[model samples]
Every structure is written in structure tokens, then in C-alpha cells.
Target: MTDDKIQELIGRCAERDVLAFEQLVRQFQSYAFALAMRLLCNEEEASDAVQESFVRVWKHLDRYDRGRKFTTWLYTIVTNISLDRLRAIKRNRRLFSSRDEDPSIDDIQDERDLHEIHSNEELAGMIRALTDELPLKQRLVFTLRDLQDLSVEEVSEASGMSIGSVKTNLHYARRRIRQRMAEKYNVERLES
Candidate 1:
């Protein structure tokens, strides 16, 4: 949807117009879910996060700044909620058991062809798998900047990080992911 249309919907939503709120949800729900899924890596949790995000959005519509992009604000909410869900899962898992073993990077054969990775879905899955080994901040920055295709500034806004922090995290995140990818598939070089 166009920014103007989204802004109009937001304006109506702010006035407590239920239909406009519904329309706004329809317009952005998929984007929100996609982001949540990338962050959470589980469909059920992603759905829950998106639902909670919309609820929060509805409750706090008045606080949304008109000058900033609506998506930036929405993404901020989703990122924060997703991070909370991740922390909760970690806490719960810790209560139940000891730490999970790290996947053996040594199992990846060096001769696998990168060209064989044809589907975007497969590549995305591989990237997500690689990201599972990253620290939370690096994963967030990498997902927001590279996977979600947000600008650095937009990632910073969404993640509530300083621009410099986002860049630094993204640099390390990309470098690490690329190293893993090369080790997995034997690529000669990867661009940062």
C-alpha cells in the first residue's frame, strides 16, 4: 500500500475507527508476520508475536510519530516483541534442561557447490540456520539489514540500536555468516 494510504488509515485508526484499524492490519500483517518468522524461526511463535504487536499498536496508536515512516514504527514494535519472546523461550528451555549442543560446523563438506542452492527459500533457511549460532544482537542486525532488506538507518530504528552499533553488528554478523557459508559450500569469495 502507498504511504499516503497507510497514513490515512493510521489517522483514522487514531480516531478509533475500527474498519480503518482492520484495514491497516490487512495491509501490513503479512510483512509483520514475515519479520516475526525471520526473527523467531517458528510459525506459531511468529503468529503470536504479530498478534501481540497489533494489539500493542492499537493500544498505542496515539504515540506513533507522524513524521517517521509507519513501517519503521511497526517494525520497532515487532522486533522488541520478538526479542522478548526469544528471551522467554531461552529462559523456559533453561529451566527444563541443560544447554543444547552447538551444531557441528565440521559436518559441512567443503566441495558442495554454491550453485546448487537454487531456491530463495532454501537459501533463506540456510541463512536462518547459520544465524541460529549468532549472538542475539548480531542476528537481529543481520536479519533486519540483509534478510529483510532494510536500510542501515531503518535497521537501527527498528532494533532500537544506535546507527554505529547497527553497522558494527551487521559487519560482524555478515562476516561470520559468510565465513560459515564459505565453509559449508566452499565459495571462493563473498561480498559484505
Candidate 2:
């Protein structure tokens, strides 16, 4: 959907128009759900977070500034909600168990020729495992910058961090992931 259309929907939504709100939800639900899934790592939890975030968005529509990007504002809400949920889960897990083994990074190397196929689900799973090892701030920056292909400024805005901090986190996150991949796959041959 176009920004103008989204803005119009937001305007109507702000006025308590139920149809416009429904339309807005349909337009942005997938994007929000994907983001929540990436952050929360479980489909059920992500769905719940997405639903809650939308409810909060509707409740706080009047606070949304028309001058800013609507999607960005919506993302901020969803991301914050997902982070809170994640933190709560982590806290609960810590309280309930002493298990500390990290999740295994899935093998992502493709058996097919690199030029023929770009299946990266395994790679994505590995990346996700590595990402899970990162601190929340670094993980958020890395996901937004590398996975989502957002600019540093956009990541900064989404994460409420400075551009420098975003850049730094992305740099380290990419470096660490690459280092892990190299160790797992044999760096010299892969490079060649």
C-alpha cells in the first residue's frame, strides 16, 4: 500500500472508524507478524504479540504523529511489545530452570551449486541461532540492518538508538556471524 493510502487510513482510524482500522490491520499485519516472529522466535508468541500490538495501536492512534512514517511508528510499537514479551520469557525460563546449553545452529550450507539455488533456510536458521546469542540491542540492530535491509538511520530510529550505535552493533553482529560460519564451513575453501 502507498504511504498516502496508509496515511488516509490512519487518519480515519484516528477518528475511530472501524472499517478504516480493519483495512489498516489487513495492510500491515503480515509485516508486523513477520517482525514479531523474528524477534520472538515462536509462531504462537509472535501472533499474540502482534494482536496485542495492534490493539495498543488502535488504542493510541490519537498519539500517532501524522508527520512521521506510519509504518515506522507502528513498527516501533510492535518491536517494543515483542521485546517486552521476550524479556519476560527469558526471565521466566531463568527462574524455572538452570539449563544453559545454547541452541544448535542449523547447518545452512547449500548442497546445490551456489549459482543454481539460493536456499538459505538452513543459513537463516543458523543466523537466527547466532542472533539469539546476541544481546537484545545488538540483535535488534543486526536484524533490522542485515535481515530487513534497513538503513542504519532507519535501524537507529526503530531501535531508539543513535546511528553510531546501530552501525557498531551491525558491524559486530555481522562479524561474529561470519566468523562462526567460517569456522563451521571451512573459511579458505568457502572463500575460494
TM-score of each candidate structure, all chains considered together = 0.84, 0.84
Residue-wise C-alpha lDDT for candidate 1, range 17-82, written one tens digit per residue:
999999999989999998998888777888999999999999999999999999999999999999
Extract clashing residue pairs from model 2: 108-123
Residue 73, candidate 1: C-alpha displacement in angstroms: 0.4
User: Candidate 1's error at 81, in angstroms?
Assistant: 0.3
Per candidate, the number of residue pairs that clash is 0, 1
**Candidate 2, poorest ten consecutive residues by summed lDDT:** 111-120
TM-score of 2: 0.84
Q: Rate the local accuracy (lDDT) of all candidates.
A: 0.84, 0.77
